[model samples]
Target: MFRSLWFDGRLRAVLAQVLIACGFAGVVGWLFWNARHNLMQRGIAMGFDFLGEAARFPISEHLLAYQPTDSYGRAFAVGLANTLYISLLVIVVSTVLGFLLALARRSRHPLVAAAATVYLEAIRNTPLVVQLLFWYSVVTLNLPAPRQALEPLPGVFLSVRGLFFPSVSWTGDLVPLAWAAGAAVVLLGARFVYKRRHRAAGARGWPWLALAAGLLLWGAWQGQVGLQSQAPVLRGLNFLGGASFTPEFSALLLGLTLYSAAFSGEIIRSGIAAVPRGQWEAARSLGLRPWTTLRWVVVPQALRIIVPPMTSQYLSIIKNTTLALAVGYPDLSFVITTTINQTGQAIEGIAILMAVYLSISLSVSLFMNLYNRRINRTQRP
Candidate 1:
């Protein structure tokens, strides 16, 4: 029986894979044991007990509320929030900028095409770190000080410290805002379902949009909610009473958006190019306008090619947010570094950082893959 099993190709393959997996697990176990033993010998502790301890470090900018007395876990959460906020902004801005760049490059106008080409070449050839540093210098060294800040628009101030603009706040009941948000979400969901079911009719979501707006207006009126806009005013040496973007954050956003957009533009351009010329001819024969053809036909077909590489580009941008450290922006990795320095729990801190990044990357990939599959399904007969 043993001889026969060894002769069976399928059985042999299974046995070989099992052996490989076992060997890998064994090696990993040994490495862990060795590391633990060494650490014990040096009296270094393990585990995550430090999470509840106060993290005295300061975070410059965060979406979530944070204080110096907050626990290490809270500080990490703040860092993760900052990372996500910047990454989300970069992804959105880059995608739009990239689409424009791709279109300009494909334009028949010589000057437009040349300008796009020049921008792409220059951006793509340089290291992203250098671009980030250069932008940092422009914001920090070249910009005017707060006392002599430039007012580019009403209630907008640009200075070495940062860009400050008016922020709107709803001074009213929270219940109305919650109801309005819920109504908007429901309307959007219904619109999505309508689009999927009636693909041929090309249903517009304007009605849904209008309904959501009406609901919001009604809610605001009932709740007596009023929007209060607070503009920044020069206060002594700095600006006060408005939302502001720090110099570091502004530099990081500008650098990441421009840098990622160049690559995204190239990827989009290639995908568009990959579509057969016959597709364009077919679109033209249908008497469709150029913009309509590109929008409805060419782009949808090109998406099959675009999505895979674009997923990678997005993942890269997420990871690149770590470069925030160079500009002193307190992203997840930055927080991890500080945690390690303060607590000497290098292993735990690094593990948390890796896990957070891995989770984010996987989530993004899964979403894009689903989107890719949907497009692929639509293309099938």
Candidate 2:
């Protein structure tokens, strides 16, 4: 009977999965019951109804309009947005910087290679919080006042408060809409033409240039160009009207990006190195130039190795955004912490925070997995 059951592959698989699920459910059920009993004995409520209660605390850096009288749910939303914003910013910056550093490590120049190595080592070895504090408190705070701010360009300023640049105000709807539509059309056309030409011979760089120029010209012709800048203007002992970047956000973003980039640089370096030397030789034998070999041959092979590990690093960056609490950044964790303390609803606050992070992480994983599958499908047999 055992042999017969084993021979029935579907039945055997189903039995195994069911047994494993039962064991997992039993463990989870026991934990839940034990926790509930403990809470009851201590006279502590364990439900999530407290999330509806008013959060009687001030949030300093709300992206949305929020007041102390706002509900706990609004506070949770504010926190989640801030966390996501910082994570997104840091990921973009770190990926760009890390890729550059990785390329630098592979440079023919000895000095460039040494410099890249040193940077990688220093950043990886330092504690992230310490680096954040140093950048925020020691570096940014020590900069000159607003009146004496660095003005490298007209209407743009950099100071201890934050970097300020002119922002465009959209007045006319049709002009801006038309410009956007035209730009999209140009970009799509350029991409199509470039891909067609590239598959044929790969010797045309003008399509991209033409697309960019066309977009710029179209946007300029539209009445969509307007500039206004209000850098920190000192009034007595304080500044006004300028976009103020809180030290918390600056520190959190800097720390996460710098720390994450170190690992990313190493990942990239390893990925590039993992591309076999024989592949390099093969490319050269095909009469490809050195630059073309790297661009078309080595890098593509390296990307397959690079992407999986890079996805993990990206996830780490997202999770580390929660560390904003340490530096008093009003990220999700900090908001949730404050909410819990004010409302005495620890369970609800913690649950919401966990759910938000889980959702964000799952979304990122889903996107990356889709891209990974596409890449895998395109790989040479």
Candidate 3:
């Protein structure tokens, strides 16, 4: 039996793979040991113990409350929150802008198509870092100061400081507001499930939107959710009261959105083009309007083709957020850099950064893959 196993091609292949794996593991172990030994000889501790120590650094733009006295872990969390906030904003805004750009390019009008083509070419050809620097300069140098801010709307101000807009403040019982939000989620979930169950009929989005709006109104009437919009006012040297986007954040977001939108538009346009011409003809023959046909027939089918490539685009967007440091936006990478400089725990800091990014990329891939499967299954006969 042993002689036969050794001679078998399949068994030999398995043995080869096992040996390669063991060799790779051994090399990794040796490298890790060598690094640790070197660090010890230099009288430097190599571990995650630095994470518990006080960061003693200030993060200029953080979603979470943080202080210099906060632990390194808390500082990391703040930085992570900022990174996620910008990334999500870029993803959402870029996707919508991209879809619109795609539609514009596909438009029969010569002028519209030409304009979109020019925009796409300009953005796609230029380096993103250069574009970011340009935006940063524009925001910080070209824009007027707070006292002379541009008021594009009733409650919006644009200035060197940032974009300030009226923001809603909820001033009511938290429990009822939570209940209302939960109910809205359940309604949306039910709509999703119903569409999944009945693929042919699918779902109409307006009904769900109306339901959520009605819930909000009902909550307002019952005093369960009291929302007041606070507008920014010039106070001292800056705008105060309403929510504001720092100049760094505004420039970074704008740069990312415009840069990514170009690629996303091309991806969407290609997907739309990939849809069989017969499908469009069939919808038109059924007396459906062009917009209706695109919405009900083409876009849904195009989504299957669009999703996979779009996943890579999204991952790119997440990774590109590391450039936020260039414009002084305090993203995770920025925090990591500061942490390394202050704590001198370069290895641990870098390891943490790698793990965070890897986890995020994997999560995005997993979600997109599942969505892709669902779309494929839905279209299957």
CA-lDDT, candidates in order: 0.93, 0.78, 0.93
Ranking by TM-score: 1, 3, 2
Better of 1 and 2 by lDDT: 1
Candidate 2 — number of clashing residue pairs? Answer: 0
Q: What is every candidate's alpha-carbon RMSD to the true fold?
A: 2.7, 4.9, 3.2
Give the local distance difference test score of model 1. 0.93
lDDT of 1 by residue, 191-289 (tens): 887777878356666887898888888888778889899999998999999899999999999999999999999999999999999989998998998
Global fold similarity of model 2 (TM-score): 0.79
Off by over 4 Å in 1: 183-218, 378-381
Those runs of model 2 whose alpha carbons end farther than 4 Å from true positions after fitting are 1-13, 41-43, 147-158, 173-232, 278-293, 379-381
- The regions of model 3 sitting more than 4 angstroms off are 179-223, 378-381
